[model samples]
Target: MLAGPAWPHSTPPDHGPDMTLDRIAQDLFSALRFYSRLPTPAPADAAELWAAPDMDRIAYAIPLAGAVMGLLGGAVLVLAAWAGLPEFLCATLAFTILVLASGAMHEDGLADTADGWGGGRDAEHRLMIMRDSRLGTFGVTALILSLLLRIGAVMALMAAFSPIQAAFALVAACAASRATGILMLRALPSARKDGASATFGQPSHKAALSCALMAAFIAALLLVPLFGLAAAVSGLALCIAVIYMMAGISRRMLGGQTGDVAGATQQISEIAFLLAVLILA
Candidate 1:
């Protein structure tokens, strides 16, 4: 496994002589490994890549990874809809594909964050609660609500628009939500010394900006054509609002950002984006 966080603080080992296409390809693979359960062939330096993922490079590729994942899940949604499946069942199946694709990493983060934020006495206590793997009442409730809300949002989108249009919305939401989540690395300090956020190292402003711009491009390319500029703009605004709200909550409760906070941000922003599409479509 990736040993203690030595490389995150230093020059990453994966850097090559230059930013060639090969390097960009490697970074994309690394991003996929970091963000999802998708099977990827190990590069020659897989050990070093896993040890200290160069978030600076990987950040740029995260939106693309999310877009790929969205396409996979959205394909299921489109096919099910075309097969005359119930909209609710199609939505649930699509959501299940997404959860399985990512191994529910974001969901786990959401649960831990809610439990810690809702039940802890202090920042330290909250961190402790988050570190515990056991599910709590707060976590259970948050997990259920998150799943239900997203599925419902998908159902609404299908009702309001065609499944193909809703699938594009899913792709845009996935890209945008992940882009929003990566900004936390720039927005707040790491909450714990050895936590995942800290171990992964803070992404520089340029990296975060690149991620955001790429996602915005993806959103515009996918969403604007379907829902119009106004709806797209509104969805983006709500995504930014989610980032700010999550940042404030994380700063107040955990004293900074963590993996869980990022996950929660993505989940909430996704719901916000889908709802915006449903309302406007």
Candidate 2:
């Protein structure tokens, strides 16, 4: 099972005040540690490995981390297709790598959110349900549907175009979806006084904006080559809409954001982005 989001009990490296290249690189490393199960090199001060990520500082680097993560999956997709695998199998293989690499961290979050929302009678009950490690029927169903939709969409993309094109689409979706999670984190208050989301803390407006801009720029660059400029813009707009709607649901249903809510935001927005591109293509 994917471990829960790691809100480590450590501190940031003293990279000084300026946003130096070293600082940015460190933040990207922090983001990878928090967001994925990839074997990133540990910091020289190993204690920082167990420290809570400075979301405000590292949040802007998340999309960059996501782009790196997605590129790995994309490479697998390309290689599998080159080896003459069917589109369905190629997409599935690539997606499997992505899930394994990330330790299904976001998938776990999506399941928890679905269970909490579907099973709870109120905010407190929902939060309690989310805290339970066991998956409910609702959670299981959500996971199945999410996985199916994502895999099928990738297959469709590959069938319609070359694997290279589909791989870039996946990269764009991954970057934009994770960036939307930052928006959800910024939009809602912490649902509880404790836990990962609360301890990880909200990103500042500047950090959130930086993340959004970078993600959008990256998505546009990759997507425009495959889809027209208009389609690229439309896909991004649809993704933002997904974030807006999810944020509203999170606020009303849970009274705030949890780690699960943020995870669910990423999973769903990724689906929306992929479908938007496919439909517009």
Candidate 3:
């Protein structure tokens, strides 16, 4: 954009925000702004970030934002358990908190993705359908199935493990799956010429790798203790596999990724990880 050499893959070059005493912390806050309803950096702190690169690199921190979300939900589960609520009720309240925190952004994506891909006969038709705000048959079905699977898996994990263990597992699943969204963003071009996903730009390989390692570390720390090394490995693999499959589908059907596709990928990866936990935990 500065009239220099072009980036490969047509992705916009990574533009760094002004470095600060708390650059990473600020990036994390920017990520929260993008991914959830949580409060972020104050106006003063946010001003510089908005000036240069915008939030192009914030994708690297999405998993951290998701980890925060998951930990908050886990806290809710623990509090509900302490209050003597039934396991199912505790699980319900925890996930409900998460859905509220994220504004169900990723869930909305999955539904729209399903409708677009399922109802359209061609890529153009599918992209147009996806751009619509209204829900349809496929969207409704996808939402119902995704919600049931996610909630059911959480309840089962609660039943199968201690509150702390279950909470850790949930946190790990969330962190790992959300990273898939970032990875997907980096791997594909935007299907549309311009939108949130396209404008966000592609993360560098190093940034993507850092996000992946952070996700893997979080998963390994929490899951290996409860489900053993083998299961933990498999579960993380499952989440990544879901990302790969979803990315493949997005590429085939829509030509590239979009904000909605990234969101849908998060939902699918979250469910896949949870299902893996249900089976192996």
The lDDT leader among the candidates is 2
| Each prediction's whole-model lDDT (CA) | 0.85, 0.86, 0.81
Clashing pairs in 3: none
Tens digit of lDDT per residue, candidate 3, span 54-165?
5446655777888999999999989998999998888889989999999999988888899999999999999899889999999999999987887788888878777888
Alpha-carbon runs more than 4 Å astray in model 2: 1-15
RMSD of each: 5.5, 5.5, 5.3
What ranking emerges by TM-score with the best candidate at the front?
2, 1, 3
Question: Clash pairs of candidate 2?
Answer: 8-51, 8-52, 10-51
- Per-model TM-score versus the true fold: 0.92, 0.92, 0.88
CA shift at 229, candidate 2, in angstroms?
1.2
Residue 218 lDDT in candidate 3: 85
lDDT of 1 by residue, 231-269 (tens): 788888888888888887788888888988899888889
Name the candidate, 2 or 3, with the larger TM-score value. 2
Superposition error at 161 for model 1 (Å): 1.0
- As a whole number from 0 to 100, the lDDT of residue 198 in candidate 3 is 74
